[model samples]
Target: MRLLPRLLIILFVIFAPLPAFAVNPDEMLSDPALEARARTLSAELRCMVCQNQSIDDSNADLAKDLRLLVRERITDGDSDDEVLNYIVSRYGEFVLLKPRFSVRTLLLWGAPVLLILAGGIALIVFARKRAGKPTGSKLTEDEKARLAELLEK
Candidate 1:
């Protein structure tokens, strides 16, 4: 019946994006505190091969390796900063999406906003100048009479 199709659609909508358990369930920590730390480190660590993605969400083999590495480092008592520094040292910063604020990244952080502000100022001045101006020449009475006469003929 029509109701069966509706039910199937509802089920599909509810479960369409469930995460794939590609990671071995055994690899997950049973201790909540350690698992929380693992997640924090995972979010901080970028996947070397998949440069834009964090290791936690990426399904790439390298991401898995990075996740395992993060857990290993955390277990070895590395602070989050130490783990981040270690990755940055090896990957040379391209792996990070959110780069640290520095002289090299100044343009990336400031250019778009500066461009937008410059554009907005230009637009405001342009609009004001345009709005203040007359659209056409103002005709004298004689000129209007001549135009009327020309139109009549």
Candidate 2:
């Protein structure tokens, strides 16, 4: 009976949703809609200091500054597109979590496929060369005779 309560408490603790933001309580917008938009924008912005983490998930000082800048832009009545454009203009496309598809990004995305195709072609060529013939020259008649004589011994 006591185990049931303990198990319930453990399950509740294990399954509870933890807070997801590194945004301080003081940094949050009072307007829930604006705050939600800020959160969304923050999530889309990459943390330059922590390359793999979104600004919203990063605890870096630069990320915090970016969060504040986003909120400031929102409060200044910038549309979501305007804010994103401003950030991109300031920080370049690399600051975006999902970069816009463009010529440069297309190259970045396509280079690996191109490399793999090249590698596969090289591998096929190599395999064909390897399969074409045995690696060494055929033994001469004299060498064969000597090999047979040695084997008999």
lDDT of 1 at 138: 95
Clashes of 1: 0
- Give the TM-score (vs. native) of candidate 1: 0.73
Q: Write the per-residue lDDT of candidate 1 for residues 1-153, one digit (tens) a residue.
A: 999999999999999998653355766777778778888777766677777777787889988887777677777888887877777787766666577778988998899999999999999999999998999899999999999999999
What TM-score does candidate 2 get on C-alpha atoms?
Answer: 0.73
Could you give candidate 2's per-residue lDDT for residues 1-153 as a string of tens digits?
999999999998987876567899999999999999999999999999999999999999999999999999999999999999999999999999998989879987888999999999999999999998888889999999999999999
* TM-score of each predicted structure versus truth: 0.73, 0.73
Candidate 2 colliding pairs: none
| Model 1: how far residue 35 lies from native, Å | 2.1
Clashes of 2: 0
Q: Model 1 Cα displacement at 68 (Å)? A: 1.4
The residue pairs that clash in candidate 1, if any, are none
